[model samples]
Every structure is written in C-alpha cells, then in structure tokens.
Target: MLLLGLFSHLLSSGKFWTTRRTNASQHIDIRFVFVIFFLLKWSHAQGSHPPRIVEHPIDTTVPRHEPATLNCKAEGSPTPTIQWFKDGVPLKILPGSHRITLPAGGLFFLKNDEPSASLKIFSADKDGLELEVKGAAPTVLRDEFRLEPQNTRIAQGDTALLECAAPRGIPEPAVSWKKGGQKLDLDSTKRIRIVDGGNLAIQDARQSDEGQYQCIAKNPVGVRESVLATLKVHVKPFIIRGPHDQTVLEGSSVTFPCRVGGDPMPDVLWLRTASGGNMPLDRVSVLEDRSLRLERVTIADEGEYSCEADNVVGAISAMGTLTVFAPPKFIQRPISKSIELGADTSFECRASGNPRPTLFWTIKNNRTIVFPGAPPLDRFQSINTEEGHSILTLTNFQRTDRDLVVVCNAMNEVATITARAQLTLDSQEDRPPPIIIAGPVNQTLPVKSLATLQCKAIGLPNPTISWYRDGIPVHPNAKVNITAAGDLIISDLDRKEDQGLYTCVASSRTGKSTWSGYLRIEVPTNPNIKFYRAPEQTKCPNAPGQPTILNASANALTIV
Candidate 1:
C-alpha cells in the first residue's frame, strides 16, 4: 500500500513536470516565430525606398515678349516623377495641349502662354499632383539718362534751372545734384534753391557761382553720372568807349572818349596792356560825360586799354585799342636835261615813306634803239635804275639823234611823280668838213712819144668827177691815151727828155683840195746795122769796090 502511494505521487509530479516543460516549449516556439517575423519586416524596410520630394523652383517672371524657362526637380525612391503646371492647373502631355510638355526632370522650357500676361505665376507639379508655385515681379530697366539745359547763362541776381531726367530704368533712381565737385544740399537760400528731381534753381547768381554743375543718379545695383554743365553769369560795368579800336596819324593829337553807364557812376581808369602799363590819373582827364580823354597819342599808345568800373561786388572792365599811323613821304632829286654824244647823264629818285617805294622807267615809241639809247634824243629813252637812281650815257651822236626826251619817275607808297627833260642837238654847221685835192696841172709832150700823168682830190664831201690838165678837162683821147679810170694820161712816145711835175686840184664847198704828179716821156733808138760780102779767096776784106757799108740810122738802108 505504501509503494503504491509513492508511485502515484511520482506520477503526479511527473505530470506536473511534463505540463511545465510543454508550456516552456510552446513559449520558446512563439518567440522563435516572432524573431523571424521581425527580421523579415526590418529587411523589407531597408530595401530601395522611394525618395521624398522637397523644394521646387519655377521662374514665372519675364518680360511680355520674352521666353521663360522653368526648373523642375524631385527627391524620390527612384527619383520621383516631375511635371509642369500653368496658372495653378495641371499641364497635360498630349498633342494640341496649349500647355506644351517638355522633357521631364531637370529643366522645363515654356513660352509666355498669354502674350499680354503681366505679373504671371508658374508652378512645378509632382507625380502626387502637389503644387509648388512662385510669382516673379516685373522689373523696369533704365537705358538712357540725361540733363536738360546742359549749358546756361544767367545774369547777376537772376534765377536759372538745371533739370535732370532718366529715360528708362528698372527702379526709379534717386537723383542728386553737385556743384564744382561738391554736393549741393537742398535748401532755400537768398541766392540759390534746390528743387525736385535734381533741379537746382539759382535764385540770384553771382560771379562766384559761375562754374560747372553735375547731376548723378543712384540705384540699388549701380550708379550713373552725367556731363557737367557750365553756368555763366554776366554783370554790367561803368564806362564803354570805342573805336574800341582807334587809328591816328603820327605826330597828331588823339582823344579817346569813354562813355559811362552803370547803376552808380564809377570812375574810369585807363590801363595800357593788362600787366604794368597803367596811365596815371594826371595823364588822363575825366570829362563831364564820364569820358576818358587822352591828350596826345604816341606810338606807345598803341595797345590794349582796360577801362575798369569798380564797386562793392567787384570791378568790371572794357577793352579798347589806340593805333598810331605814319603817312608815306618821298625825298629825291629832280631829273635834268643833257646834250652831247658819248656823254654820261644821271638822275636821282630817293623816296622815304612808311613803307619803301619801288622805281621803274618806260619808253613811249616803238623804235628799236641801243641801250641808254639817245637820251633826250630821238623820242623818249627809258633808263634802267641800279638801286633807285637811273643812269644814261649816249655813245656817238649823229645828226639823226635829236628831239628825244629822258624821263625819271619817283614813286612812293602812296603816289608816283615823274620828271622829264628834252634834248636839243647842236647845229651841224658848227662841224668842220674834210679836205681833198688832185695833182699834175698840165704837160707838153714830143711827137710820136708816150706820156704818163695822174690827178687825185680829197674833200669832206668825197669829191667826184673829171680830171683837168692846164685847166682843160682831160679824157681818153686816142692819140693821147689815159688809164686808171681817166686819172692818168699818156701821149705818143717821141723823145727821152720830156718829164715834168703836173698839178691836180679838187675843191668842195666845204674846203679847198689839191694833188699833183710828174709826167714822163720816152723815145725809141735806131735799127741794128750788119755787113755782107761775096767770097774772093777770102781776100779784099776792104776792097773799095768789093766792101759793103751799112747805116741803121737811115729809115731805109741798102745791103750788098
């Protein structure tokens, strides 16, 4: 009974043990299954996940006529899909879709859908249809900027305007004004005012304000400057006189009248040359009409004269000139007449003037004559000048050289004066004539003989004509021969003792002329004599009856 109870307790214990073990096993199995499920879920969560989309930018701001480009991008598991939208509406990718489709992802180009669109907005559409839109503000770009009244002139105590404007700009820029490299503040002054849009008004300009004014424009991105404008101011002074230029003859008195006009009568001071040549008050007199008078003008008076009018504001001046002139003058000797051939003549023409003078000579007739031709003879003869004097010399005067005139002219800067003289030739009768004469007055000759004689004459008239012997004119007589053109004659030869001196004379009304020569006569001798005899044994060379007698003296002789 005890053993049976033990066994039964063991069995019960065993059953309890078995039940706990089975429970533990079941818990372990459930844990094992849960671990495998967690692992699978973690693995699936770590694999290739889709990327998340973030910021998207699209440019919608562009000019009305300009094209625009939109940038679309996405962050996704495999780069999430991207698309474009217009005016908050999805853009369809199809033909005839007014909203044109572009390549997806990085860049998207689009035209301004509405040609007149202004202030439009563009957006990027994601695959989830998420919209990211932004608006672009229209900008104005400035092109040209300039200033009005670029240059101006204003009188003292007068107002002038300097205006500035811009043609086109992205933003309305601020305009500022500067004067002489310094900024001009906006204020209402007694003589200046700054107006809107960079306009400066000179309420009352003065000489001090005459300078350059510049306008500058300022903007967010850049700064632009314009040309500087010049401003001139004019003020009146006291005295005004002219010829403002004056010309006066040398050694003459001149008066320069200074007329004064101004608010207050200002004393006039004459200044020669701007530097140091100022005329003293005593040298210049102030007339009742406010005229500046100069007593006598000299060459020193020729220069710039400043007539200054002085007051509190400043001193204003006017300029004038005084000129002195010297007239031309001539100093020369007169031309004189002269006679005689191969003689030297002189004429003097000296001129003195402001400017030197020129001298020249001219002939009247067309006759061709030698140089220094027949001075005061045969018409007029022009003599050339060496410097300012004319010289003439006639070489050998003939009776034909008469009634000529020599002229000399002296010319100065202003005028020309001529002096002339006439030539009177000496009478021809006062000259002596040459003399001529002939010789062999007369001669006697023997019968049947030869005679030679000659006659020559000399005279100033070159005497001509017949020869004479014993006052009888001789010619070529046949019995009494003459030769050498009747100057010599020869009679028949008769005897040897007939030679004598003969006289010949020639005469002209101008003078006596004479000449002479000798005449010679010659006669021939008797004929030659000869003897001839007959041969008688070569004897009886002188036999009285057999001998021959010859006489050549006889005109006729006999020979035996």
Candidate 2:
C-alpha cells in the first residue's frame, strides 16, 4: 500500500508537467506519456515490497528532562510516510512543540518533554505496523537542579517538605541542604531529614525553623545551586512578660506591660471584653509603648484588659487584671417613697466601687430579705443591672408597711455605706377579699397523667389558700400534692375517681373568698375493628415445588 501511494504521486506529477506546458512549442508527446504509464504498470506487475522497519524504537528510561530520538527507518521499493504513535494513539505532529517528525521520518523529543510508553510505527498509507519496539532502557532527560515550592509559610507544629531535583546528570548528584549559612543535619531522628527522592523535611517547625534555605546538587560533572527558598513558620503571638495583675488605690497611676515575639512583626491592640460588648481601646486611657497606662485610675478604669497581637499568619491575646481600690460610695441612693394603699412601688439605689459593692435593702428591724412565705408576686425583687437600675420592688403596699424605714446597704472590701428611706403611705381602705388572679381553669386530661390546677389569688394582709374537693377539705398525699402557691398537683390520676369539681378558698385576717374549677379525666379506649383479610399467599396455596409469584402490575399494591 505504501508503494502504491508513491507510485500514484509519481504518476500525477508526470501528468502535471506535460499538461501545462511552459512554452507553446512544447506539446504533449503522447508516446512519452504512454511509455511512462507503461513503466508504472510494469512496475506494479513486478510487485514492490511493502515498507519494513529496519531500525525499531525501544523503551528508554531517560532523565526526567533530556533530549530523545526515535529512529523509524524502513527498507522498501519506495520510501514510506512514517507516523508515530504512543499508547495506541497517533501523535499530533507540531513543528514548534520540540517534538516533531522530519521528512525522512526521524522523530525528535526535546528536553523537558516526556516520550511516550509503547512506541509504535505506522505507515501513513495504512499498511499496518511493522516496527519491533522491544521495550527496555532507562532514558533520563537532562535538567539542572530546580527546587519546588520557592517560598512557603506553615504554622508551628506542622511538617515541611521541600524537594530538590537534579536531572540528566551522568551520575546521580548528592543533595545537601543549608539554612542561614549552617549545614542542615539530616539526622536519623527523622525530624530533619533528607528522604527518598532528595527531599528535605522538618517535623514540627518552630521559630528556629524560620530561615532562607538552599539546596546544593553536586556531581563529578558540575555543582548546581537551586534558587533560594524560604521556610517561614508562622508563630502565634505570646506574651513574654505581661498579663500581670495589679491592685492599686483610687487616684493612683497604673501600667500594664506586654511583650510579644513572632515572625513578620504583628500588630498590637488593647481591648476590654465585657458581656455588654467590646469596649473600644480609645474609650479607655492607654499608652501604646507595649503597655497600657491609667493616670487617675478609678472603678470605671478597673477591668480585665487584653493585649492582642496579630499578623497575616496568626493572632494571640493576653489579659491583665486591673483592680482599683475604692470605698463604697452611693451613686444614687433610694429616696423616701409615698404611695396610696394597695399601690406597687420600687426602692432603688446604686453605688460604684472596685471589688463590686453588694447592694441590699434592710428593713428597720434589720431584715435584709423579705419573708419566704410572702407571695412570689408580692416579694421584694432584685433588679439586674442590665436594666440600668438596681432596685427592690414593694408590691401591694399596706398600712402595716407605712412609716417603715428601710436601709440600702452597699459594701465592698474597702468600705460600706447605708442610706435609709422611710415609706410614707396615705390612709388605706379596709383590706378586700382575695380575688382569683390566674388559672384553676376547667380542663380535661388523660388518665394516669399528671395535672396541675394553678389557683393564684391576690389580696392585702397576705392570703392563706385552702383547697376542697366536692365541698370537702382536701388533704395532700403521695399522689395528691399541694404547692406553696396553692396550686394542686394530681399524679397518676384515676379516670373516674379524680373527675370532680374542685374549689380553692383564700382567706386573710381581712376577709375570705372562694373560686372553683372542674376536671374531667379521660382514659383512652381501644380502636374499633373495621375489616380484615387474609393475604393472597395464605388464601391461595401454591402447588408443591412451585413458587408463589407476586403480581408486578401497578395496581397490585392498592390499599383498601
């Protein structure tokens, strides 16, 4: 087939020259054309030999980057058009790609290019492959030392791997590493090592690991130096001297010192992290000389201060506690409050000091806490500072509370202050009967479950609650418990026995009143049966040795 292509090309060229005559005098000589055509037919009759490969390509293991050549010469009547293939695929020939085939069928593989595995030779005329590509030889390509990862940054406690390679050397080069003019010890501990494939590795990089690194490749041919690479180990900021706690008197000067060290020099900031939010550093007195200073330190200036340092790599913070000694001083003391009977009122006071002063309300009789038996709603409640006020509430003022003097006590480690406020009340009307305030509403519940009938009443002179079941006094037992708030809890209730009208009677020295609610306990009943059907497999028995096949139709699974 290759010979036939060459024969056809020769015939075509001969016809073109004769048909387009350069001179009019030159005419087509029919005899010459006949002779040329005859010669071609005679040659075809003689039978030309198909292209046969004399030199074959073989497998080679060259250096990673080295020039290569694959010879594919053939012996035939006419020269063959050689096409190269790798891994069963035709190679696309490009002139500037450093990998190309010449007119004579010589193939070139430039440096830094990988020649394929399983080199195959084919005739462009599709005459089938005839080359014997016996696979062998390690052909390494040529390249000077080149190190990967020119520069890198990794945090401490991580591994660093840097590889340096020397390609195409006659003898494999010995690789050595250096950092900061000191020879790197590739020891047996494997911490700092030169591993397989000329890799320099370090385990758990530290501050000492930060340095410019170089890889040297040496052989009898020459010594090569790789481009300098840097191993930057990111280190978090650490306070070397600071986070010192100081306790100073008010109107004293104080300073917080902080020292930190890391690579790339980090930024520093002082912050006061509070539950409310971060207080901007500018809001407080500070000095930027690696320290924070407070000239006239007061309670407001006392807090846990932070020194934070950060860089592109990481960040860290150190806290220093500042304590300013200040005696308790009332910022605002509770004033005397006058209100009508049965009115709700609040008594408030606030003080500022370091070591935070505890504020409390003390009655004239030295009672700092309201009686435990007092209704939860009518008790003296402490207001949280989140509301911007420190207060104690006096709910439902009565005649007995009139003229009662109460003291607001604020104390800290330094000192204590007491401010008194006398309650002045107008003449009050007679105490009214208890009025039901919440719950004890009618309800239906499942049997064997727990239930609470909350009965809350509000009145003057404090009320005492009593419960009755079916008009009779009810006593608390294991399954029936009455809370201090007069709410009744029935546990493991019976369906029929626990269903009844329940009453709550509240009474005080002033008067008595009653309220009622009803409970219906429901026990669950079994679901009624509708219909049942035997499965088809049980109703229609299959013959022995025969399988019961299920229907595959869409309606086979319809539910009733």
TM-score of each: 0.29, 0.37
Candidate 2 TM-score versus the reference: 0.37
Number of the top lDDT candidate: 2
Residue 388 Cα positional deviation in candidate 1, in Å, after optimal superposition: 63
Question: Which lDDT tens digits does candidate 2 get at residues 1-560?
Answer: 55566655645553221111111111111110110011112233356665566766544333435666655566655455555544445568775787767555666667634533432322223323333333432223234554443787877878888777754343467778888877787764568888776778889888788898888776554556777889889876666777678999898788888778776667888777653435534444555557777677666676788889888678888888878898878889888765677898888888877677877666775465542234443346665475334677788888778777878888888898889887766332333455666546677776787777777676654578988888988899989989998888899989676879889898876577788888777654524422222232236453455322211111121111
Superposition TM-score, candidate 1 onto the true structure: 0.29
**lDDT of each prediction vs. the true structure?**
0.47, 0.63
Compared with the true structure, the alpha-carbon lDDT of candidate 1 equals: 0.47
For each candidate, how many residue pairs have backbone atoms clashing (under 3 Å)?
42, 16
Write the residue-wise lDDT of candidate 1 on 1-560 in tens digits: 33234335544553220011111110011000000000111122344443333544422334433444444444544344564433333445566543443454433334343421122222112222222333332223243565544888665676778777743443566777778889876653556655676677887677788889887776553466778899877664544553277776556665656666543445566667833786744556766765566766545556777667764434667777776655434455444333455444444445443334444443323233324324564433445454544454444554444445544455554466655544434332432332332244444444465455544443334445355544555565565554443355555544442354444455444444456554534323323322111223225243254423221111222235
Of candidate 1, the 10-residue stretch with the lowest lDDT total is: 29-38
